[model samples]
Each structure stands twice: as structure tokens, then as C-alpha cells.
Target: MTDQLPDAIVAGPKGPALDLLHIVQINEEIKSVVAVAFKINIMALNAIFLAKRAGTAALGFGVLSNELRSFSSQLRETMLSLNALIHASVDGVSAMLQDSRYNDILERAVVLASKNKHLQEVIEQRENATDQFRSKLSGLRRALRSSVDDAYRLVELGGVLAKSAKIEAAYGAGFSSSLSQVSGEFDGIVEEIRTSLDTLRKSSFFRG
Candidate 1:
């Protein structure tokens, strides 16, 4: 979703509408997490190949690499869900802002035409629409919150897996150094994802 809201919506006569800049910030952080996930997958593949070259000695390391690959796939799916939630939220917030503007205009018209029966009907319709948008937005936010929590847990799992890979790397015989290097890379990438998600969770959209 675009960061810019309509000027009329942003500078509503009532006051500034909801700032959408936070949504943009949230998207950036999610993109970062997604990129890190991609890197994790690549690293996992490389580790797997290295483990194979180390023969039976690196059997445990090979198993950990496969788990890491699976974790990366799960993380990618979670990020996709998050991106969809963010888009839905942006649409909902935009609709709410537009509705607020219409209500403002309708209120002024009502004051000027107090005896106009049709104006009341229009105002009621707009109020109903606003309520619907609000309810939808609330649900989207809840889903977004849950998805972020899932992402956090997955990253924590990745961290544990990376540590396990490091331990297994020690048994890689002649390939121990190469396996260790790949495992270290896994640690770094997982940490990067963790940090990105931390920032995303702190964004205003995630807060109550």
C-alpha cells in the first residue's frame, strides 16, 4: 500500500487523519525479514552440500541443515501472511479516513439544513459504513499481531537450530571448518531477522 493518503483525507478539517507512515515503516521491516529468510534458505542449502562432502561424519549437520531449510520456508510463509494483513489494514484505514471526511461534510450540511429529512438518512448510512470499516480494521490488526508473534517464534527456532548446527559442525571431520563457517552464517542471518521483527513489533500499528 502507498504511504500517501489523499490530501483531503490527511488534512481533514477535523484534524490530521491516521498517519500511514507507520505502515510504510512496517512494510520495510517485513521486507528486510523476508530477505533474511531467503538468505537462510541459501545458507541451509550450502550447508547441506558441505555436509554431504564430509561423508558420514557430518550426518547430524546434514539433518540440521534440512531442518533449517524447512524453518526458512515456514518463515517465508509467515511473512507472506503478514504482508497481506498489512495491505488489508491500509485499505481499511483509507476507507475509514474517507468515510470520516464524508461524515464531516454531512454534519455541516445537516447543520445548514436541519429540517432536511434525507440528510439524516445519509448520515446514518455513513455512520454504519464507518462502523463496518472499524470492525474490519480491528480484525486485521489482530491477525497481524498473531502473524508477527508466529514469525518471532520461528526466528527463535531458527536460532536454536543454528546453534545445533554449530555443534554438529564440530563433527564434520575434514570439513569441520567449512561446516562451522556456514553455521556461523546461519547465526548471523537469524539474528538479523530477529532484530527486524523486533522493530516491526514496536511499530504503532502493532500496539493496542
Candidate 2:
């Protein structure tokens, strides 16, 4: 992902590392993924029931369905964590912006009261606050990247499981067609989640 912020968010030494609106958009996207994951879990349970109805011929398919259900749960959990990280980052950015404004006002005050030692001390304190916020934002960015990577890996594993399910479906005898349809649904849902993640990774916050 590019380190460049989009035109909508101001980028500079004084501006925030990320904007609130952008963070809100990211949260909405993650929510969509969570919704999709929920659907996947339900579909997996249905597939498991169908496999059981098919008897021993669909044993492998049943196992894969169970695995898919577990995977969906994992994906949802990862997304919730990501959402929390984003919220924390937003809080940090807001604090930094407030500190920056205070610093700017203090610097102007220093110009008027150049001989005031107390005002200079306050300015120094504000500067320290800004630095602390920057450090926090940096740590949060790293965490967001790590979480995104974990999510990407999980989605990849889901894709593998979906393909395996499709293969196993072929051994379902009379239930092969039904099993195949469920596998296709799984693949499609996984692809949708992957697409959303790709978009999120391309956002400015994921930048180095």
C-alpha cells in the first residue's frame, strides 16, 4: 500500500496522520465484512446438515464445512479487532490535532510576550504532548498493519478450504450437485471478503 494520503485528507507536518472521515469509511467497510462472515457461518452450518443427510459418501465434505464455519468465526473476530485499532488511532489523531492547535496559539503568544519565561515553558510542554501523540500514532499504525496481515492470511486459508470442499463434493455421490453449489457459494463469499481487505490495505493508514 502507498504511504500517500488521498487528496481528501490533508497531509503535512502539522496535519493529522489520518482523518476522521476516512477512519469512519474504513470502519464501515470492516462492518460489511463482518456481515458477510456471518452469512458464511450460516451457510457452512447448512452445508454440514446437508452433508450429514448424504451419509458416509459425503464425510469429507462435512469435515470441510465444519472447518469453514470455524474459519468464518475467526475472520469476524479479526475484523472486530481491526475496528478497535482504528478507533484507537482516531482518538490519537484527535488528541494530536488538539495539541497542535494549542501549540500554534502558544507560539503566537510567545511572539507577543518574548520575555515571558512561563509562557515558553507551557509551549515546551505542548510540544512534548505532540511528540507523545505522534509516537502513539506510530505504534497504532504498526498494529493495524499486523492485524491486516493476519486477516489476509486467514482469508487465503479460507480460499484453500473452499477449493478443497469443492473437490470433496465430487465424492458426494447422489448429493454431488448440491454439495458443489454450496462450495461455489463459499468461494464467492470468500472472494468478496478478500476484495474488501484489498481496498482497505490500499487506504492511506496502511502505508509505511
Model 1 segments more than 4 A misplaced: 1-19, 110-117
Cα lDDT of model 2 overall?
A: 0.88
TM-score of 2: 0.85
The residue-by-residue lDDT of candidate 1 on 4-113, one tens digit each, is: 89886776533214435667678888988888898889889988888888989999999999999999999999999899988987787777778877888889999999
Evaluate all candidate structures by whole-model CA lDDT and list the values in order: 0.85, 0.88
List pairs with backbone clashes in candidate 2: none
